[model samples]
Target: MKNLNEPTQENVEFMIEEIKVKLRMATAAAMQASSFTVERYEDIKDLYEVVASKEKFSISEVEALVSELGQLRK
Candidate 1:
């Protein structure tokens, strides 16, 4: 979305924090194993794109989706 251009500073920061949250959940589920997989990377990229476009999210819904995506990664 947003023509695939770079996000604003606020959006970039938000995406970074959101990605960290998702990564942490994924890593915890992986249980000391590697969580850097194609699916995980795609999840990060897709969510970043969404956030960059919408610039808004419902915390509960986003966290739930993030958790599901974590499971999907591996």
Candidate 2:
């Protein structure tokens, strides 16, 4: 999310789109679910919670999450 910082209408939309993409990819997989899938699911769940919660994300927290996402690709 370039801007899923709080609950701004735009940011919520962005977060929803991001989650949808993840969900679609997961569902589209022909292979059986594995630990990797589980991990990604958990990550999505955590992201949903963060975006859904009323609390605003701190700069450091967002940075950490961004870093985590980058690491996930590797």
Candidate 3:
């Protein structure tokens, strides 16, 4: 197995692009679902309000949701 911590330039670039693709897909899926669907709209709306409100967004929570959002895209 390769050393996970010691990533090469190519590996880093691939990871970055992969994360970008996932983020974009996650964002699109979220927007579509939130706007058109009603399954989890209330929950998502609450979360969005918390994140987009006058207060600052929670970094850890958003990062955690990024993974959850990526899963939701699938």
lDDT of 2 by residue, 26-58 (tens): 332332222123334445446656645634556
Kindly indicate the candidate among 2 and 3 with the higher TM-score.
2
Per-model TM-score versus the true fold: 0.37, 0.37, 0.34
Candidate 1 lowest-lDDT run of ten:
30-39
Best prediction by lDDT: 1
Instruction: List residue ranges in candidate 1 displaced over 4 A.
Output: 1-18, 21-34, 39-44
Candidate 2 CA-lDDT value:
0.44
Clashing residue pairs in candidate 3, if any? none
Residues 1-74, model 3: lDDT tens digits: 22324334443333333333434434543433322233333443434334334343355655765655444331
| Residue pairs of candidate 1 with colliding backbone atoms | none
lDDT of each: 0.49, 0.44, 0.40
Query: In model 3, which range of ten residues has the least summed lDDT?
Result: 29-38
